[model samples]
Target chain A: MTFTETLQTKKFIVTAELFPPKGTNLKPLLEKAELLRGRIDGFNVTDNQRAVMRLGSLAICSILQKQGLEPIMQMTCRDRNRIALESDLLSAAALGIENILILSGDHPSQGDHKEAKVVYDLDPVQLLKTARTLETGVDLAGKKLDGSPKFCLGAVVNPMAEQLDLQLAMVEKKIEAGAQFFQTQPVFEKKLLELFLCKTKDLPVKFLIGVFLLKNSQIAMFMKEKLGINIPDEYIKRLATAASPLDEGIKIAAELISAMKPQVQGVHIMALGLEEHIPEILNKVK
Target chain B: MIITKQKELDKILEKLKNRKNIFIVGCAACATKCATGGEDQVQALSVEMSKHGLAILGSMVLDTPCDIRVVKKDLARDDKAQKAESLVLLTCGAGVQAISSVLEDKELVPALDTMFLGTIERLGNFHQFCSLCGDCIIDETGGICPVTRCAKSLVNGPCGGALKGKCEVNSENDCAWITIYDKLKKNKTGIKKYHNIKNNAAVNKPQKVKTR
Candidate 1:
């Protein structure tokens, strides 16, 4: 079945993110894929996650699909211009990897070697629009592809931004660009999530709220202060007061999943070193 | 042009664990011009590995390894998977990973360290200019790199180590502060204007943060 069909069938679809290893060792990554197989609706393999070099996402996704797991290939515009990007899209379709998460990646400077040049030929919005164009057998510049790609296009959102209106505006723009689903950054506050959803009610896109497992209070604080994430102070205090910080963090995460269950279509558990805890989160939600 | 160095080559060989049957892979992409792990680099690696008594099974260089179609066709037609015990990649980390994505069983190794996205300084020299701090400071420095220029990455004037015309560390290269000073003066701009440029303290270093 197609990735979208699978997502629609699962009531509260669960997906996990896996990054290809930095070095040539694939045993660990393959082992991770085997562990996650059949447990989640689909797994996401990031494209050059954080702009640092690693294995390509399309190749990794292909490996996952070979293992009987559905793979969602994340495509970024940081490295490729329109020509290269569209070609890769067509290739993705040819390989039967249907789900795509379009993103205007972080600059090369944000990667391991600061000297990389960036090719921001098309931003995420433009890329989504280009994908639609490619579906019709045309390129971004209106040229024809030998054969077009059939893609289930997805985009990203940061709902925890300080400016709710601006974030909502971006959502609308993504929808206009033909994004069918959106996976947001980690959601720590239910109220803010509600506010974002309410504003985007008119958008015809499925929203997947990002639920990251907090390892400790330091990580929670890092999310808030450094990443501009909005976790309520009261929640932080509650986690701090708990007897076991790890257990408290899981409790808080479960509470978030419960709160957001009725609001969005699904929750994308970020696992983030707590892949084992996903079973716990899923068990609680079930 | 594909760019590579001996250090990167050493790392890839190290990953091979000194295996004998090796298939050296190259790319027709960015590395082709920099000449590090492109077609020539792969041939060079084959010979060098053979000198170390390693069996050079064969070599192939795709137009672009990241282009899935090219890689898929090449792998299918060549059937290097059957012949070579291990594959050594000379392209960027993306290219190496792309090849790995398709060939599930074969062992893949990276021959070059995928460093920063940089531009060629002259014909052969390449230098990094921006850090992509999510904030740009090019307007203040007159388009010359302060991030890579100043030894300390100082955004302001040259440090005490700046000499008459060259940097303190390397006399061969012009001092970054001197370049900035000359550029601003030539543009009839005040040096004070450049000092007020704020560094993006919040911008995290562009290293890979594995979010698995």
Candidate 2:
């Protein structure tokens, strides 16, 4: 079944965001995919996550689809212009890959290639519209395409944005841009998620709360400080003082997933190279 | 107006290091206001060139070097200009380009680097005001430009990296979005951000203007 059908089926969907390896040694990713094949409803493959060059998401998603898995191509506008992006979209559609998650990726300065030129030819909104436009058999330049991709379009949200009103505007804009669903920035605080969900309850889009397996307080702080993702003091306190950070982190993450199960359509687990921990955390969701 | 800075004397001398007869051109409008290609600046450069042991073929501070007609007509009358082997411009990039396009045979070297369309903040300080982006959204963005000001040029809103109302890229500068929000709040216009900027064909390059 298409990912759109899965979301509309009223069943709790489980998705995982995975990064492509930097090199051709796909054994690690293949093994992770093998482990995660049936476990996840869909796999969200990253395109050069953190702007560090990797195997292209198009290639990786194709690999996953061949393995009998539904891969959501997470495309960023940082690297490609409209022509290249449209070309890739048509090719991806031709390859039988269906789902796409669009994002305005992080700046290149934050990555290893500080000198690399960042091409934000079209921002996230434009990309979302382009995805929708292609489905209508028309490209960005208004030219009719021979064939178009039927994309199950998705976008991202930052639930903890300081200017919640502006952040809501982003969500509203994405919805207007033809995003069918949204996966959000990592949510560790249950209260914050509850508040955000309350504000956005009337919106038509289905939301998947972003939850990751936090290994330690140091990792939590790193995400908070370096990544600009907010981690509330309460959760940080628990991880900081716990004797076994991994256990505490897993427990907290599992607890968050359980708390949000009723509040959200699903949860997207960013396993952080600890794919095994995701299954373990799922076991604690009850 | 376009802002410019004079190129180093040694560099200008190095280009003239090979040529003997050199003519100088300066702009009276933008370059003069910025003290880059003004008459005084051009005269100062001429004195500096003579000190370097090269023939000063005379200089003319054009009313506007970017005006091709003025550039062609003014250079046409100067006796020393007709004899000069090469021309140096203390004007902005547009001026250098205009002269280059006009002077078919003579060598062209720029004596100033055009910076940006600047607003004079004060007597000696100039700040880049506009990015020359064709689609002017300052009307919607509370007269503050995220396209030019925001380090990421995000059209939607500030990036997650912004901290304490300051930009994530340069902490010293106030976040452009924050500044806009403050302006909108102060003016009671309501804080606004454009989720979808229309296709920017106007800003697409090789843009030309012909106002009748």
Local accuracy by lDDT, each model? 0.73, 0.82
Q: Please, what's the RMSD in Å of model 2?
A: 3.8
CA lDDT of A125 in candidate 1? 69
Local error of candidate 1 at B62, Å? 51
lDDT of 2 by residue, B1-212 (tens): 78888878888888888688899988889888898888899899999888878888788888877878887888756787778898888888778777777777888889998788888987458876578877777887788887788766777666555666677667777878777776776554344344454456777877788998
Report the poorest 10 consecutive residues by lDDT, candidate 2 chain A.
Answer: A161-170
Spell out the clash pairs found in candidate 2.
Answer: none
The parts of candidate 1 lying over 4 Å away from their true place are: A238-244, B1-212
Q: Residues A160-269, candidate 2: write the lDDT tens digits.
A: 76666667767887888888899888887767788899999999988998998888889999888865777887878899999989888889888988888887889899
Candidate 2 deviant stretches above 4 angstroms: A112-118, A213-219, A233-252, A271-277, A283-286, B5-24, B38-60, B79-84, B123-129, B150-161, B169-200
| lDDT of each residue in A147-168, candidate 1, tens digit only | 6788888988877754344345
Give the distance in Å from residue A44's predicted Cα in candidate 1 to where it truly belongs: 1.2
